[model samples]
Target: MIEPASITNVMRALADPTRRAVYERIASSDEITVVELTRGSGVTQGAISQHLKSLKQAGLVAERPEGRNVYYRAEPEGLTPLVDWMSHYGVFWRERFTNLRTLLKEIDP
Candidate 1:
C-alpha cells in the first residue's frame, strides 16, 4: 500500500509539467539518462536532473548508475494506487452521466 504522505508527494511531483513530461518519457522507455531527457525535451540538463530528483523522492522513479551514466526509469507500481483511486471515481462519474443522460432523454421525450 502507498503511504498517504508518499501519495501526496507523488501528486506534487506530477503537478509540474516538466516533471510530468519527464515521467512520461521514462515510463515509455526502459531507462534514460538526464542528458537524453534534456535533449529530447529541449530542457536543460540541470533542469532534467532536478525533476528527476523530485521524481525519485516521490517514489515515481528510480535511478541506477551504470559506469559513468545514471539512468532513470519509472517505478511501475508506484502509480497503481493512484490509478485505482481514479478508476473508482471514473466509475462513479460514468454512472452519474448515464443517469443524467436518461433524465435529459425523459425531459426531451
Candidate 2:
C-alpha cells in the first residue's frame, strides 16, 4: 500500500513552480552546486538554498557537502513509492482489458 504521507510530500514539494524547477534541474544533472543553480534562475542564492532545503525535506533531492560547497542531486528512489502506487493502476487496466477481450472472444467465437 502507498502511504498517504509519501504521496502528500511529493505533491506538496512539486506544488511550487520554483521548487519544481529546482528539483527538475537537479534531476537532470548528476550534481549541481548552489552557485551553478543560481545562474539564470532569477531567484537569489538564499532563495535557492531555501528551496533546496524544502526539496531535501520532501526527499526529492539529496545534498552532499564537498569542502566549501554543497551539491544537490536527484534522489530517484524517493519517488519510488509514488511510482509504485501509480503503477498499480496500469496493471489494473491491463488486466481489466484482457478480461474484456476474453469475454468478447467467447461471445464471438
Candidate 3:
C-alpha cells in the first residue's frame, strides 16, 4: 500500500544508475541477495544496502530476512501509477497525431 506522492519518491530513488541497475536485476529475478546485486556492479555491498534502504522507503522494493541473509525483490506494481500517467499522455499524443493526419489529408484533397 503506497501513496501517490511516494511514486515520485520511487522515481527519484530509481534515478541513480546503481539503484536502477539493482532494481532491474531484482525485477528480472525472483529474489536477489545484496552480495548478488553487488557482484558485477563494482559497488560495495554497503552502498547497495544504502540504495536498498532508499528503495524500500520508496515502496519500490521489499526485503525478507532468512538466517543472516537478506533477499530483495521488486514491487513491480509500485510503478503502475507512473506507467498509467505515461499512458494517458500517450493517448493525448495519439489523438493529436490523428487530428494532424486528418488536417493534412484535407489540405491535400
Maximum-TM-score candidate: 3
lDDT of each: 0.88, 0.91, 0.87
Off by over 4 Å in 1: 1-3, 101-109
Writing each residue's lDDT as its tens digit, candidate 3 over 1-109 gives 3356866887798899888888899899999999999999899989999999988888889999999889999998778767776788899999999999999999997
Lowest-lDDT window of 10 residues in candidate 1?
1-10
lDDT tens digits, residue span 26-63, model 2: 99999999999999999999999999988888788999
Cα misplacement distance, residue 80 of candidate 2 (Å): 0.7
Work out the TM-score per prediction.
0.78, 0.80, 0.88
* Comparing 1 and 2 on lDDT, the stronger one: 2
Candidate 2: 10-residue stretch with minimal lDDT: 77-86
In model 3, the Cα lDDT at residue 26 comes to: 88
Error of 1 at 72 (Å): 0.8
Candidate 1 structure quality by residue, lDDT tens digits, 1-109: 4467867887899999989999999999999988889895888888889999998988889999999999999997778667766888899999999999999999996
- Candidate 1 CA-lDDT value: 0.88
C-alpha displacement of 18 in model 3, angstroms?
1.6
